[model samples]
Target: MKYGSTSAPIQLARGQAMSSVKPWRPDEPAATIHAEGAWLQGAFISKIFYGIIIVLSWQCLSLLWRQTTRSNYKTKMSFLAIVFAIFSFSTLHSGYDMKAIQLGFVENRNFPGGPSAYATLSRSDTPGNIACILMQWLCDALLIWRFVMIYRGCVAPMWLLAATPITVYLGSIVIGILFTIKKLTSGSGVRRT
Candidate 1:
């Protein structure tokens, strides 16, 4: 027989027969969790991780901004702008993800139905993804700019100034690439019934 085919029947003894089924227990919860709940729980954990990263990045930027009295006004303003952009993007992404999770988890059904469900359920179409991409690029640029400013203003060695930007860019690139890969490969997995 072919796989998944159920055409074959079992022979039973003359006295054997199926018994009536019992109702599910009231005290026992459903054995399987909904896909929406699972997705939202994952998103919540991710949001928390990203939130901590944002906080640490902001603190580092703040320290750099405070030490900017020794640098030029233009550089200071540029740094401030970069910091503001990062903060805005982080906040926006976090808020949007939270909303998406809330809608998916609380509603238990995609909004409106049909095509609308795709729009409601997918994070790729959300503003958060775009913001996240932009923020990642901005972070790389800011790191490079900070390194340049430090090198020019304080006569610091190129290697010393390169450290932060190199590390930040690598980290951002890794994160962006991983997220993209996850989005792409997730579709190939077996879907829940």
Candidate 2:
């Protein structure tokens, strides 16, 4: 072994001598693997989100079902139960798609499209993204309804306060529509070598 040889290839930059190569890799992976990379593929986190939504819906329904002693509130209570269940089911459907992508696409093909295909909104999972937006819209509408219930009428202040969220809700819907259109327009990713 040559000790302290000047021919050891020291790098020179801007008339200054520099030694050692800069590291081309991080000290650690960008994301720490949790539950065996489940988080990266979105399977673990999606399941947890679904579980939390289910638990909260179940609790709300339990309370509603137990307290309904009148026919008027009966319809309202049933409506809530239905809406919550529908939204929760929609969320679960998205999670199901995530799991399928993780298993069938990523793991099966050895992550051919990389991890981005598994997590981000792809061509197939567009409906899942729409469902999430719809659910969020419904939740916001329900909150506005709660305020209406409290004010006993659609007063000016209530409407004034609702302007911002309603505008945001509409904006999100427009964005979702635009995204869907863009996705459809950019179809057929198949390539020939």
Per-candidate alpha-carbon RMSD to the true structure: 13.7, 11.9
In model 1, where do residues sit more than 4 Å from their true spots?
1-38, 108-125, 143-193
How far off is residue 44 in model 1, in Å? 1.7
The clash count of every prediction, one per candidate, is 0, 0
Query: What is the alpha-carbon lDDT for the whole of candidate 1?
Result: 0.63
Candidate 2 similarity to native, TM-score: 0.61
CA lDDT, every model vs. true structure: 0.63, 0.60
Q: Report the error of model 2 at residue 1, Å.
A: 48
Question: Per-residue alpha-carbon lDDT of model 1 for 20-99, expressed as tens digits?
Answer: 54332222234323444456577779778777868876886877677677547677767677777887888888887776
Candidate 1, residue 184: lDDT: 52
* Most accurate candidate by lDDT: 1
